[model samples]
Target: MIQIQEPKSPWEIVHMDWVTALPPGGDRSYNACLVLVDRYSKTPMFLPCHKDDTAMDTAIMIWNKVISHTGLFQNIISDRDPKFTSALWTNLHNLFGTKLSFSTAYHPQTDGLAERMIQTLEDMIRRFCAYGLEFKDSDGFTHDWCTLIPALELAYKTSIHSSTGKTPAMLEKGWNPRLPYDTLKKDLVDIHPTASSFKIMLDKARHHANRCMQDSFKYAKERWDKSHKPPDFKIGDLVLVSTLNFNNIKGPKKLKDSFAGPFMIKALHGPNAVQLELTGELMNKHQTFTVVLIKKLQLK
Candidate 1:
């Protein structure tokens, strides 16, 4: 299996994805969230947006919200969503010298950081709403989701991350933001370190975080490789593809064929994906697939 390169610095590699199809909230009627995750810190920025937002809108939003703060990222990892695949989005990043890495079809694990963060954000929202956390505006209209986002974001950033062993705020900003409880504490001292001293502390925290991340990756790879054997696929080999993600299949799923083709492997993409020589009927389908979804064809 091809190992994804770990980012060496904050905002060097970012993962972008959308959490769509939510109940409309707030004045602008936002029904979706644009999620951008920093791979190094595991810090996420959740921007409320519309589900039908186009590529241009997405680009503008990222420019204003993310790029304005972090300057520019070296790479962006995302799924093959139309907004990401569009010429506009591709060219915009290309002009800025940023590479866009698209994940293979039916594979969310390629951008797993964003996927996991979405789940966490959704769970937090559910729990908050379930607890009857609602607030009324000056006009007396009660809002649930829009009001909860800021609190959720703060809570997520302050919480210690498993892989990093430090809170995202600590890793990203070198300091934890003051919460409401901090205002009530009489013993709290407002101490601001010198710029050089603060920089040294931030560097040390990042150094520690990187080591923790490396350990986490090593442990995860060991656990995953135990159950998953990497398939040795060569060019020109005939293989059958799993139909688990195919949408064209009709009738009951259990009755349908589990595998399709005897398609010939035309090219290999790293060790985890391949390009198949597909027939005209399957022309519209994705030609590239992850190695886990393919098996060698056996003949008697």
Candidate 2:
């Protein structure tokens, strides 16, 4: 099993999640954790935080860090909890024209990638925090959650990923980090013969990974194409955009009610993107959204 952040673009489809739990002490009610994931590169930015992480706080925390580094994502997938659907959360996405999608209510597999990674992360944190409590600094004892999150994340990503047979670090950067293990003496290592024939083995591995990815995508697309009939929506029609926003939090991941609009179709791109014109705020928001978010209110 691999710990995967969504892997946005270089910066799109970023997934942000908050895990609530006890503070440094079981008595401290405020302790929670926040994690930001890039869907494309599988990179993670983590924060050790409190449960009072309301939607506004969540948006601010992300905006401050993510924008400083990776700018913005076109889409963000998160659960439809109060922290995500609060008006503050909606306004943030609207301000940037980013679309939000919520996970399936009862079925978490829609957001399984993030959930799995976070579960793995929490486990590691529990172990580290146990060890950290032993030390006293100067006058006081403390477990620095912020101090440890990065290292834990790094160790998790550098570890080999089973399905891809590569580390998340390597996948993101196209290179492996030189670790203490790598620096160990050759005599102390069981270095494979693949190391001796570097170029040849590297080529083989890349080819294999690429082929596997291609095959997976192909199979999924084929299955999706075969099972369902095409849903038809037309231009110049009223539609509901089923996406997650600050105040509008009710829907599943795949198909749900995200928005209600008397959207008139302006242009058709592919089998979707039924464009509409609006004078004020909503127009800019729609400009960033794709046709996949909308469904024809009246079938025609």
Candidate 3:
């Protein structure tokens, strides 16, 4: 299994993914949402986007919604989406001194943070749609999807996260944002600390959050390692890849070949994935396969 390193500070690493195939909504006919999550603080930004947005369009939207507000981050982890893998996107990040890492084909665990966040966002949207709430934008235009984003974002940011034991706003800003419930209680008072004291408090909060994240990662790794073992195949090794993801294969799955190839390994991707020397029609497919989807072939 590939071990994901915990970030030392907020926004040091960010994970990004897109939620697509959504019903077209809003005046702009937005059909997708770009999800970006800070690896350290677990903070998220959900930007409305079109399903067919080009690489340059995605880059511009990210700049306007996230990078412009948070400044430059050190690294970004994402799936091999066309927009993320495009030369334009890679070159732009290279210019900004940011490293881009892509997860292995068919492996979402590498960008688990963003994937989980997307699930949460989808659940919220489903519930909202069920209630059939009517929400309007600042222009007084009714938007089916875009208008609900701000409220959903606020609810997600203000709630305590299970992994960090802190709310995203608390971890990132070092202070809990006031909620409407605070206004109902007369016992609540507004206390503003001095600049130096505020800085000290922020540092303490970050330190605590770091510890919490480390502990969470340790526990998760231990549990995962109990059932998963490291891959042993190396370069030039003969292996057989599972046909689970192949779509071109016809006939009943039970009757179809369970695995294909005796393809030779071209390279190793970390400890969990590998690149294979595939030929024929397979060349049209992704050559990289997760270790679980391939096994070392035993020669007769």
lDDT of 1 by residue, 158-207 (tens): 77886789988888878888864334434536633443343333343334
Computed on alpha carbons, the lDDT of every model, listed in order, comes to 0.69, 0.54, 0.69
Cα TM-score per model:
0.68, 0.51, 0.66
Give the Å shift of residue 4 in candidate 1: 4.4
Model 3: lDDT equals 0.69
Q: In model 2, where is the ten-residue run with the lowest total lDDT? A: 104-113
lDDT value for candidate 2? 0.54
Ranking by TM-score: 1, 3, 2
lDDT of 3 by residue, 68-126 (tens): 77888888887778888899988998898888877666654363344445455544444
> In model 3, which runs have C-alpha deviations exceeding 4 angstroms?
1-5, 111-133, 136-141, 181-259, 262-280, 283-287, 290-300
What TM-score would candidate 1 get against the native? 0.68
**What is candidate 1's CA lDDT for residue 183?**
49
Error of 2 at 32 (Å): 0.9
**What does candidate 2's lDDT look like per residue over 1-300, in tens digits?**
112244434567666666555346423433666766666666666666677766667667777766777777877776556777778778877987978776533212233345445444444455444433322233343325444344556655576664467776776677877754335454635655545344333333334334433454455456545743444766566666644552333345545434656566665544323455543335544332344456666665
